[model samples]
Target: MEAESREAGPSAALMSAIVTEHFVLQSAAGTTVSEALGRSSLYLSALSSSLIALGFASQTPGLLLPFAAAALPTVFVLGVFTMVRLVGTGVQNVLYLSSISRIRGYYRTLDPEAARYFARWGAGEGETDDALGSLAVQGGPMAGLFTAASMIAIINGVLAGVCLALLTYYVVTDHHLPAALAVGLFAAATSLTVFFRYQHRRYLKVQQ
Candidate 1:
C-alpha cells in the first residue's frame, strides 16, 4: 500500500503538469493571433496616411483599388490569419456555449469538494509549476516568441547600421560632416524612440 501510494503521487503530478501546459499554449496562441492582427493594423494605417497625403482618391466613394496596392500585403496577411483562427473553432464554439450552461448548473450545486477543486485549479496555478514556465524555461514556443521578437530587434539594428553607412557616404561625398551628424543623430533618436514606445506599450499591456 505504501509503494502504491508513492507511485500514484507522481502519476497525479504528471497529469496536472499536462493540464498546466495546455492552458499556457492556449494563452500563447491567442497572443500570437493578436500580434499578427496588430501588424496588419500598422500596415493599414501607414497605407492610409501615405495614400491620403499623395491625393490618391477623389471625394467620391466608388473608386479605390489601383490606388491601394500598398495595402495588398496587409490584406493577404489578414486573410491567412483569419483561416488560422478558424482552427478548432467548431469545438470551442460548442464547448464554450455548453460549458456556460452546464458550468452554471454545476456551480449552483457546488459543495466543499468543488470549492477545493476551484481553489486548486480555478486560476490555473497548480501545485506544480506552469507548463510555459517549465517547458519554455529552457526552450519552446514561448522561447520561439522571444526569439521572434529578438529577430525583429536584430533586423531593426541592421537597418540602423545601413543608415549609419549611408550617413558615412554622405559625409565623405558632400564634405558636410555637420549635416551628416545631424541627420544621423536624428535618425538614431527617431528609431530608438519608436522602438522603445512600441516595447513600452507592449510591456504595459502585458502587465495589465
Candidate 2:
C-alpha cells in the first residue's frame, strides 16, 4: 500500500492547488468589476455637471433650450448603456459567488474537517466561510448608492424634466401651439421610456 499512497498524495495536493486557484481568480475578477463600476460613475457625473455649468454660463435660455433638446436623446441613450453595464456587472457578481460556493462544497467533500472553518460564529451552522466572503474585495463609491447605473438614471430623469419645463416655457413665451404639442409629446415619451425600461429589466430578471 506504500506505492499506492505515494501516488495518491501528489494527486490530492494538485487538486487542492487547482481549487485554490479558482477561488483566487474569482476574487480578483470581483475586484476588477468593482473598479470599473466606480470609474464609470465618476466619469458620467463629471460630464453631466460640466455640461450643466456650460449651459448656464451661456446666459441664453432660449438657446439653451434648443441645445438641451438636441442633447436629450443622447442622454437617454447613455442611461440605457449604463444600465446594460450594470446588468453585466451584476452577472459577474453572481458568477463569482456561485464559483466560490462550489469551491466550498468541494472543500467539504475533500476533508470534512474543514467544515468548521466556514461556520458562522457560535452557530457552527456552516457560516464561517460566509463571514469571510462578506469581506469586501474592493470598496468605495461602487459599493454605495453612487453606482454608474444610479447616476445615469438620475441624470437622465433630470434631463427629461428640464427639457419638458423648458419646452413649456418656450411655448408660453412664444404662444406656439406646435411647441406646446411637442412638449406634451416629450412628456409622454419620457413616461413610456421609464415604464418600459423597468419592464425590460424585470423581464431580464425573469429570464435569468
Candidate 3:
C-alpha cells in the first residue's frame, strides 16, 4: 500500500482538504491575535483615561505631571506589546493567505467547473492588492495609512507623543530644562527599543 501510494500520489481532494484545514487554522490564529490586541488596547485606554481623570480631580502636587511621568513607562510597555501582537496577527494572516494561494493553484490544475469555485473571490490569483498591497502605491496622498501596521504605528505614536510631553513637563517643572531633555532622550530610547526589539525583525526586515 505504501509503494502504491508513493507511485500514485495523493488525490486532489485530499490535498485540498489539507490545505483548507491549514487555512482555517491560520485564520483562527489571526482572529485570536486580533482579539488580544483589541482587549489590550481597550484596557490600556480605559486605565490611562481613568488615571488622568483621577489625577486631575485630586489635590496632587505637580499638577498630575508626576502621575503622567510614572505612566510613561507603562505606556511604552503597552505600545511594545501592541506591536508584538500586531506582528503575530500579521504573520498569521500571511500564512492564511499563502494557504489560500496554494489552494487556488491546486484549483487551477482542476477542470474548469471545479476551478470556477475558487475564482477571484477577492483574494485573487495574481492581483495581490487585497490588504497590504496598498504599500506599493505611490503618491495617493493617503496610501501610507492603509495597512494594519501603519494603523498600529499611528495610534501608538500619538500615545507616545502624549506620554513624552507629559514626562517632559513633569521633569521641567520638578527639575529643570536639562532634566526634561534627559527625559526626552529616554523617550527616544524607549521607542527605539520597542521598534528594534519587537517590530523591526518581524515587520521591517528585508526579504533578501
Candidate with top TM-score is 3
Q: What is the per-residue lDDT of model 3 for residues 1-208, given as tens digits with 9 covering 90 to 100?
A: 8898756766779887877786786577568557756856764685578567756745766546555556655765666666666666664554455455556656666665866775544433332222233234322223333445545555565557557655566544664666666666666556645554544455333211
Would you estimate the TM-scores of all the predictions? 0.31, 0.58, 0.60
Off by over 4 Å in 3: 1-16, 19-23, 26-33, 36-40, 47-51, 54-63, 120-145, 172-208
Q: How high is the lDDT of residue 150 in model 3?
A: 48
- Full ranking by TM-score: 3, 2, 1
lDDT of 1 by residue, 1-208 (tens): 8799765544657546655655654565556546655654554465456447436554546333333333433433443343233322312322332233333334434454554443322222321212223223222223222433333333343335335544454435465666656665665556545544554444333222
lDDT of 2 at 203: 31
lDDT of 3 at 49: 80
The runs of at least 3 residues in candidate 1 whose Cα sits more than 4 Å from the true structure, single-residue gaps closed, are 1-147, 164-173
List lDDT for all candidates, in order.
0.41, 0.55, 0.56
Question: Could you give me the TM-score of model 2 versus the true structure?
Answer: 0.58
Clashing pairs in model 1, backbone N/Cα/C closer than 3 A: none
